[model samples]
Target: MITVDEIKRMLPHRYPMLLVDRVTELVPGERASGLKAVTCNEPWYEGMPDTATEEDYHYPWTVLIESWCHVAGVLVTWDRPNPDVRSGKAMLLGGIADAEFHRPVVPGDVVEHHVRLARQVGETYVFEGESLVGKETALTIGRLTMTMRPASDLTAPPVPDPL
Candidate 1:
């Protein structure tokens, strides 16, 4: 088991963005399971209109996906110190596929993400997972890919005109 403080060390996310609260299970380079508590105090809830409909009040799907990715991040980096913190490298979201949101997540919900390593190529890792609220699945990710590289490489030079 890993505490929130330890998870903070493994992931670059913080405050409202740090979705994973604790890791209950981890198998280095294999799989991981983590939890996140959804609360009305989150930044996303700020300025929400009092008259907003149920659809408008749903938790952002992107953040839910990111929470799952954070769990996968722990699984991928389990064998080494966090590259984002230790070496100033950046861990990035490369791609996501077949991501389906099944139910709306409310403020009082506790999301549990279960992730498995699907593949790895060089510094890129692919994961398959699902996010659940109790026994009900909230979302299913068919494939999610992440890549780690020097932060300096993130800047784009320029695009030339087609000849």
Candidate 2:
């Protein structure tokens, strides 16, 4: 069982951008299952057309793709005991294979991401992931090919105040 705090240690994502809320199953070198509790307060919800009136907005295609990638990364990155230098770093999207969206996902939905390791070719780890909302499969298929990168690439340096 992986808690939100434990997930923080495994991946560099945080706050608004961090997607996975919990991890129910983590089988090293095989698969992983994660949960994302989507809510109306999510930053993306504000820009959605139907969100202003409290109606469920059609989830953006890009965000759905990103979410799939994030979960895939988590599956691969957490496959082994994390290395010291790898902590706080992120898995960069090296490529994608067979990515296809099946249905729409809306707000107030609990998205469950299931990822399986497809193969590791050279420096890239390939993962196939799917997102489900309740009994409906919102997204049927996608693959994330990723390589690890420094945390600095994902974070901005602190700006100093005027003296």
Candidate 3:
């Protein structure tokens, strides 16, 4: 199991943005399974009014996908750890497709994300998986791609297009 502190070292994400709680299973460069528990005390829930219902506390899809991707990041960085994305190489999302949300994930729902490497081409890796809450699958990822590129390259001035 990869603890939160260990995950912090493998991933650049932090509080509020760091949604992955713990990784229960990991096979470097192959596959991984992680968990994230949604609580009512999260920052997003702070803005909820007293009149809010259960649906009002539903977890955001963006956060869900990001948390799952963090697990994928761990698999990618297990051997070559890059704690800082500002330098070294950074993992960037190339694509995410066919994300089917089966049901709403609400507060108290512990999401179990199962992700595996679908393919690897050069510095890019494709992942496909699904997330579940107990027996119900919440989201099915048809394909998710991540590419590693130097941070400097990303921030460097773009080349001018000569017409």
Candidate 4:
């Protein structure tokens, strides 16, 4: 088991935004499995009104995908850990394709994301996998691409809104 502390040593993600809670399994340069325990304490739930219904509490799909990506991030960077993006190459999501959500994730759910390295070319990596709640699959990552770029590349000023 990789504690959240260890995960912090691998990825630059931090709390609330640091969706992955712990890594249960990891095969460096190959595959990994990690967990995220959803809870009402999550900042995303703070905006709820007193009238909010059960549907309103379902974990946002965007956050779910982000959580899964964090695990994949751990897998690809395990062999070459770079927690600080200021010094070494940093991993960035290049693309997400064919993702399918199987069920609604609620506050009580514990999601386990399983990620596999499908292929790698130069600094780019292709990963495939799924997330599960209990024994049932919760989401499928049909294809996700990640790339390694020099830390300096990530320092480019944010693009201005076209509006």
Candidate 5:
């Protein structure tokens, strides 16, 4: 089991963006399971109007996907010592394919992310997993790929003025 503090040390995320709360199970290069407690106090829920519809109030799918990716990040870097702690490198989400959302996730949900490392080729890691709320699968990810590289490599060049 890994505490939130330990998770913080391993991941680059912070408040509001740091999704994974605890890691209950992990196997260095094979698989992992993590938990994320969603609450109404989240930043995404701050401005939600009382008159909002269920669709409008539902937790964003993008954030849900990110939460899963964060867990995958921890699993991939498990064997390394403080892999993301102030390191100039970062794990980038290369791509996501075949994602399907089956149920809506709300504030009171405790999301359980289960991930399995399918394979690794060079610096790229491929993963397959699902996010569950209780016994129901909330989301299924058929393929999620991540690549580790220097953070500087992702910096975009300044845009030129309009012609």
Candidate 6:
């Protein structure tokens, strides 16, 4: 099992961008299961200076997709034996297909993300990932294609206090 503190070693994303909270299961070229605990303190909640309430805070669809991508990236990295020594790679979101959102995700939700490698051709890894809030599915079967970049690209500092 990989906790949020451990995930920081593999990815350079910091607070507000670092999405995955914990990685429970990982299998190389197979599948991975990740956990994310959403909270009211999420930086996205703070809007402009005039914002009085969070009712207007909207979680963009693109950001949600990015979260999914982060899950997939963690799976791939954790699959390796020595993730720390590795230069740290970047998974570019090539594309997303057959994506459907059933409901909105609010604060105080523990979302489980399951990502499996559906197939791989050349450098592209095709994966099927979904997000669930308890028993209810927030996202359905969706396809994601990501291309790996050299591990040297992760130059940013580690994410802090997001668990």
lDDT of every model, 2 decimals: 0.82, 0.69, 0.85, 0.85, 0.83, 0.71
Model 1 reaches what TM-score against the true structure? Answer: 0.89
Tens digits of per-residue lDDT for model 3 on 95-150?
88898888889988999999999888878888999899999999889998888878
What TM-score against the true fold does each predicted structure earn? Answer: 0.89, 0.76, 0.91, 0.90, 0.89, 0.77
Q: Point out the worst 10-residue segment of candidate 6 by lDDT.
A: 154-163
Error of model 1, residue 17, in angstroms: 1.4
TM-score of 4: 0.90
Query: In model 1, what lDDT does residue 55 have?
Result: 72
Which 10-residue span in candidate 1 carries the lowest summed lDDT?
A: 154-163
Q: Comparing candidate 3 with candidate 6, which one achieves the higher lDDT? A: 3
Clashes of 2: 0
Candidate 5: give the clashing pairs. Answer: none
Better of 3 and 5 by lDDT: 3
Using lDDT as the measure, name the better of candidate 4 and candidate 6.
Answer: 4
lDDT tens per residue, model 4, 1-163: 9888888888877776789999999987889999999999999999799999999998999999999999988887776788877887666777888899888899999999999988887777788999999999889988888887877887673222121
CA RMSD of all predictions? 4.5, 8.2, 4.0, 4.4, 5.6, 7.2
lDDT of 6 by residue, 23-57 (tens): 88888789988888877677866644674545554
**Model 1 misplaced regions, further than 4 Å:** 83-86, 156-163
Residue-level lDDT tens digits of model 1 in 14-109: 776788888999987788999999988889989988998877768899989988888988887666657364466567887788999998898889
Model 5 per-residue lDDT tens digits across residues 1-163: 9888888777777887889999989988899999999888989988888998878767899999999998998897666634453454677777788899999999889999999999888778889999999999999999988877766666753222111
Clashes of 1: 0
Which candidate comes out best when scored by TM-score?
3
Instruction: Give the Å error, residue 160, model 4.
Output: 21
How close to the true structure is residue 9 of candidate 6, measured as C-alpha lDDT? Answer: 69
